[model samples]
Target: MNGRSIATSAMLYTVTAATLVFIAAPLLVTMSLSVSDTQFVSFPPRGFTLAWYGKVLRDPDFQSALSFSLWLASFATFGALVLGLPAAFALVRFPVPGGAAIRSLLLSPLIFPVLVTGLGLLQLFSMLGWGSVPVNLLIAHILVTSPYVVRTVSASLMLADITLEEAARTLGASRWRTFRRVTLPQIAPGVAAGGLFAFMVSFDNYPVSMWLADAQNDPMPMFIYRKATGVFDPSVATVSTLLIGLAIVVVLILDRLVGLRRAMGM
Candidate 1:
């Protein structure tokens, strides 16, 4: 290779290595702290033990928060898919007036500050006299997660082969039939990717859950935040490490089912 090409390749490798270390360092420290035999979060743990993990496992508040988080994420992903798929179809298939504006509005949550969205939802719920905490969380999570579904489905739809749909139509297939047999299969990977993204977003959500949660119904992120800021225990590290492990497992499963490159629209 030429000198210039070698220089560019060296620069890219250095940047990639730096980026990976930057991201992984904190997580590695947290994992180490979780296994350390220390009362407080200390680097270079005095000794290694799994007591912190045991403590987190037995904590009732943690259990409740985890259960609530799982349910909320599941509900939010389902709702996002239901609401977003139709919106995606309309935006992609139909050339409505101000179509770009409508699509932007649908995806505004991704760009808008999450705190602002949470506060706005709080006000809306207060005005409507909605006292149901779980229901409010469900709505907030749906609002945040729906954009992932719309964006992914829109990309999939854009890449889809229109000739197949045309051929199906020419064969006397109904619109719904064509969608189910032809279009749905083509976009299924995108839908699955979107659903996974939505679920992960809702699961780890804190700002919106913080605004909506009551004393009795804290989500996992809120629970973790309180534990980290209030008590500052290594048990929190254990919980975090476990969650990170879960997230990694989920990503591996997704990569197994759909090529990660395709899922990311790369």
Candidate 2:
């Protein structure tokens, strides 16, 4: 290669390495601190121990928040799938009137600031006399997460073979049968990806939960925030490390089920 080409390659490698370090430094520090024997969070963590992880795990408040967050994310993901699949099918398969406009409306939640969306939902729910924190949080999470589902599933649908559905229908197979056998299989990866996104987003959400959660029903993110700000200890880092581990496990499962690149719409 020419000197100029070699120089450009070296620069690209340097930039890539710098970018990765910038992103991973905080995560590495948090993971390191989680194992620290120190009472408080510290960098270049002192002698290693897993006691902080045990402490966080044993906390009743943490247990409750983890359970609630899991339940909320599961339901929110289900709701998003139920609503998004149909919306995606309609937009991709049919020549619906002003389909582009409809799509933009459906995805507006992602475009708008989630904090602003949470505040708006808080006002709307208060006005509607919806006093149930769980229900309100579920609805708000679905509102935000459904956009991800719609986008991913729509990408899948656009890439799917319409001729297969048509062939099945021509062979006397019902629409439902064709969809169950052909269309669903084609889009399953996207559905799984969207569900993963929805679950993660809902579980990690703080702004929406902050507006909607009560003392009786705090999600993990809010719980972690309270613990971090109130105590400022390694237990908080332990919780963060655990969450990072959970995300890695979930991604591994998704990769096993449907090749990660395909699931990611690549």
Using lDDT, give the best candidate's number: 2
The alpha-carbon deviation from the true structure for residue 122 of candidate 1, after best TM-score superposition, in angstroms, is 0.7
RMSD of each: 1.3, 1.0
Q: Write the per-residue lDDT of candidate 2 for residues 138-175, one digit (tens) a residue.
A: 99999999999999999999999999999999999898
Please identify model 1 stretches exceeding 4 Å from their true place: none
The 0-to-1 C-alpha lDDT of every candidate, in the order given, reads 0.92, 0.94
- TM-score of candidate 2 versus the correct structure, residues matched by position: 0.98
